[model samples]
Target: MRIFRFSLLTLCLLLSSIISFTLYAANDWYRPPVAVSWYWQLNGTVNENHDVDLYNIDLFDSSAELIQRLQASDKKVICYFSAGSYEDWRPDADQFAEKDMGKTLSGWDNERWLDIRSTMVHQVLLRRLDLAVEKGCSGVALGEVDSYRTNTGFYFRQDDQLRFNHIMAEEAHQRGLAIGLVINADQVRELVDYFDFALNEQCFEYSQCSSYGAFIKNEKPVLNAEYRRIYVDDKEERNSMCQNALTLQFSSILLSKKLDGSLYKPCR
Candidate 1:
């Protein structure tokens, strides 16, 4: 029998290369470590020079070429879409029956909560996933996923929400895409296992930062957005918030509530 051998240094280098290659191959999905900076812009022309690791952009608005550009620069892209809401402005809006829509989202005129359990809604969302695939999105950030927590004019048991969320995760994974839950802190524990990341809004301001502790503990990135006017101008307040976020190991930013690319502040 022939024996094959490698020196200690050669073996270490080989193992390091294997680990790097595994991570490189898994670029189809995002699994960010603690404190990864990311950018979220749902409106206006995407400002692609943020020096961030990830870009969450509107799935319908971002062109495939833009996504390819970001990936070419070694950045991951997470396509944004309402998984549990109906947006009348979307290209596929006409596909949703009026029955599938619930009350208008309080602040947004064009958005309405969706009947998450409806079969038609599922089909529409499946098509959205297909769009994400065609755009070469590394993953997706599913908005309004915790619809059961709101008065959406549709009855939803907690288990119904869980089932819906699980299916979203399963489907995205099956398509080789990672999935994130947005502002759905209530089910962090329940979904931490299924979701690749969590996108939170004002969790620190609401004293809800601790809700995503499980995500940090799991080594999954928690992208928190703080819209406080203070964060945009007051250095002391902004520093304090950043300190708290850093302590929590969260990747946080201060932005306009519009998410219109009007403001951008990342907690280092």
Candidate 2:
């Protein structure tokens, strides 16, 4: 009885330590709210005039001073990068091995799908995350994260994608950086607990906005961008879209497909 009691006590202490560490890890990083007003611009000069809570800009294009300027203005900046695909224009594009490169993404030239299971790929992305840390980004917006749902000329099981995403999230947290799942709505329920937030593109147009209810219910932010012309050209479409977004508690905005600063209509 004495031995059993000591073992039980040991187990209890171990469990307590684990729970404490998990909570610490979760709270140690940044957590954006469900109602956060954010902007996503990948091209041209980043417009800083919007009364938004966060700015999502290209990771490489943004200067450290720009990140500092945004943070100084009391806005959180989420550095953007393509984690699941290889973009040839990046400075570190050559770091990806030929074997890891797959078919080109539709309508996106010079960008090819990457093998999600590559250790080398993970290392390269680790450096990208490090860059985010070095540049003082509050969080990272990982694009093309739903490679499993695309025709990437690679055989990626759902488990493979999940493992890869988990690695990215774990590594991001290890560096005290928050990360969001960009447009990977299919895995929203499974990954909501792991990611800090969700960024969906055209979910309203495609009738996929409901998938992100999981994020809102969990009190995590769902930042959606609609590029459809109807939302921009018609007042009725804009109102309906904004209504759904408001009902869903999403930080929705109408943006250009180019993602330039020329377009900005946010529905808070």
Candidate 3:
């Protein structure tokens, strides 16, 4: 009887230790800093020798095999998905409820804003995160999360946006993946704290790049994309952008409007 009691206690202690260690290890897995080179176009193959730490690619456009290939080359992959908007062209577009969708995204015809407050939208996003994990993605870039600030037709307030963004971050973290926030320049101050990193579009073009310095200050990288044609045609503009990016320590890339795999240049 004494021996059996001792054995049971030992088994319980071992199980507890294993559980604690697993939890710690899981927390450490998703906390690594991200340094990504983005390729949205489908034409040219990814240049694996750019000294970049990560590659952000379209979740649907690039297959799991391609992501595995990049990882085999010792690069982390961040899968890009539109979490807060309903894109009509996506394969999973039919899954979104019509009532959960709001106004069409300004300047974007094929996409519409999603009601962040809707439980249905949350369920869809959770499935998307699950898809990311299943596809072997190291992290996720949740695009267009600032719908509340726009004319989303949902009558969303700032507090609602904050709640939704925080929930998104928490859900990503829970899945052992880092989440990046792609927000307009105006909401950076409010949403920066909830995101692991940031993906900003045309901040340099608008002279709002300085507003995102907080992320760099916190040792988090800010990946900026510029879509201006001059950056590609004019050597002078490219030089200036490169110099500015180098000084700011921000990873900047000039991409075409199509987001097809054509990368003009990278500002290191």
Candidate 4:
């Protein structure tokens, strides 16, 4: 009887350990580690042979087959979409109402800022999230989330932006998808806990790269892009820039301003 009791206790302890480990793993879900290699191709043909850990591509432009192909190669896909802007070129563009759109983007004529507080906009963004799940994307990179900081023509404040960003992160996680905070560097301290990773543009050029230290502190990946012509044309400068990126523990890439998959220099 004594031997049987000891055996039972050991079994129980082993089972408990297994269960605890499983729960810990399940909690990790789609969150990528810090400094994960990635390919950010929002335009042109997607070359999946880049041998990267993650691929950030257009949610609307990439076909389901392409995303599946990447997954077959054991790569994770992060779909990109403008969550805070209404682009007239998208298939769902007509769904946005005139009242929900604010000011047009400074350089992009076809795109306009969205009223992040609008019910219609929320519904649209939710639908987009659903599409990401349907397409088998492991995560999403929500662009234009910092419209509140711009002259969006709406009476938006920081509080409104925080609320909207929280809703987005909650919705993505509830659907079993990771969400990447894009370019709202100012909100990193507030939204870091809510997001899985981050993608930034021109932060290195504009001296805003330090804003992403919160993500580094949490061991989340911070993928940055530098579009300055010097980074592209000069090899010595590119090498120096990449060293700086490495010191910062950022997975940095030097790409064209268009992000057309033409030039890719990863800081390994």
Candidate 5:
């Protein structure tokens, strides 16, 4: 009888362990829904009246106090950090190894592609995630994740990209923060299952808005930004874009190239 009782106790302990592991796994798989009051600019003060559901701000530029203030106002704050590229202006830029750095991004003069497979780059990104957590961000926006499709100068393959993306999701989940992927519309189908939501640029202007429907199909929001010259210069085009954004069910906004807090014309 004693041996039987010991065995039963051991089995109970094992089952408890399994249940704990399952709960952790389930939490990692779950992602919170977002509403956009997103601002990419890191230099200026956040408008208190934006009344956005989620605000995406630079992880390095903004303080924890600002994130807390937003949260106090019933807003979720998502910290924006570049997981795939190296920006020279960032405070931790010097920590990136020279060998891990690749070709300069096409339009962004001060940034360069990073080798996602490099151990050094991974360490740096881990530190960034730690920072995001410390700042009390509800989620993280990983930028430039599709280096496999870009002129990365690293000869990276699609499999490499997939592995990198999965690792990113794992890291974010481990830290108890939701993870978001920002990608060009072309890679949406390939990465739809992994990302919590989609942050798209100019999908309406390029007529590739339909490609991001995969995220919507998964019951995730698609936050879009359109930078058409007419949308900025002409009021009529802005009104039309707002209407189109409503029909598409995208939380669309108009942002300038500098991404400063100048004008955030949301779709009303």
Candidate 6:
């Protein structure tokens, strides 16, 4: 009888462990819902007055107090930072090595493609993620994860980008913060499960919005922005786009190409 009781107790403990692990695996991150309203302003002082479900703002430029204030207003904050590129104007710009720098981005002359495989670059990104945690951000928006598809000067293939992106996602999750994929639609299939949500630009304008449908299928949010002038200036065109965006189940917004806090037109 003693041996039988001991075995039963051990089985009960094992079952409890399994249940705990499953719960952790299932909800280890904050997954944004489809069609959730969000304000995207990464270029200037964030206007926290927008009544939305989420706010994607600059990680470095925005202060810890601002994040707390947004949280106080019942908003989830997604801190934005360029994880896959090296910006010359950032406060930690001097920490990057010359060898780690690559070709300039097509339109943004001040920003350059980063060697994502570099340990030095990874260290810098880790520090940035730590900063997001320190500031009490709910999630992080990692920009430029698709530099492999650009003229980045580095010969980064799909695997390289995937490994680097996984590292970023893992680091964010480790700190109990969610992470979003930014405009890397090509790798959506491989990365959908890794990232909590997506931050896309011009997917509709480029006819690539369908590529992000996988997120909707999996019950994840695809926060999108269309910078086309017609969508911003013409009410008819904007309504038409919003109609399609609703059908696609995307959280769409209209903004200027500059991404300043000035222009904001939600599709809902």
C-alpha lDDT score of every prediction, in listed order: 0.91, 0.92, 0.78, 0.92, 0.82, 0.90
Model 6 C-alpha RMSD to native: 5.7
Q: Which is superior by TM-score, 2 or 6?
A: 2
RMSD of each: 8.7, 6.2, 4.3, 7.8, 4.4, 5.7
Question: Which order, best to worst by lDDT?
Answer: 4, 2, 1, 6, 5, 3
Give per-residue CA lDDT, model 6, range 216-253, as digits (tens): 99999999999999887799999999999999889999
lDDT score, candidate 6, position 73: 96
Per-residue alpha-carbon lDDT of candidate 5 for residues 1-268, written as tens digits (9 for 90 to 100): 4554458889999999888866765585436554444545555776656767878888998899988998899877878888999999999999999899999998888999999999889999999989998999888889888889888889998889888988987788777777887865767787777778788788888888898888877878888888787998899988988888778777788887567777777886
Stretches of model 6 off by over 4 angstroms after superposition: 1-28
How much lDDT does candidate 5 score? 0.82
Model 2 has an lDDT value of: 0.92
Q: Which residue pairs of candidate 1 clash?
A: none
What range of 10 consecutive residues in model 1 has the weakest lDDT sum? 21-30
Residues 1-268 of candidate 3 have per-residue lDDT tens digits of 4554458889999999888867853574443353445444433455555455678777777788888988888877888888889999888889889988888887889999999999988988898888888888888888888777788878998888888888888888777778888755666777777677888888888898998888887777788889898999999998999799878878788988666655556775
**Clash totals in order:** 0, 0, 6, 0, 0, 0
- Candidate 4 residues 41-125, lDDT tens each? 9989998899999999999999999999999999999999999999999999999999999898999899999999999999999
| Candidate 1 residue runs with Cα over 4 Å from true position | 1-28
Global Cα lDDT for candidate 6: 0.90
Q: Rank the candidates by TM-score, best first.
A: 2, 4, 6, 1, 5, 3
Candidate with the larger lDDT of 1 and 2:
2
Residue pairs clashing, model 4: none
lDDT of 5 at 159: 87
TM-score for all models, in order of appearance: 0.88, 0.90, 0.85, 0.89, 0.86, 0.89
User: Worst ten-residue run, lDDT, model 4?
Assistant: 20-29
TM-score of predicted structure 2 = 0.90
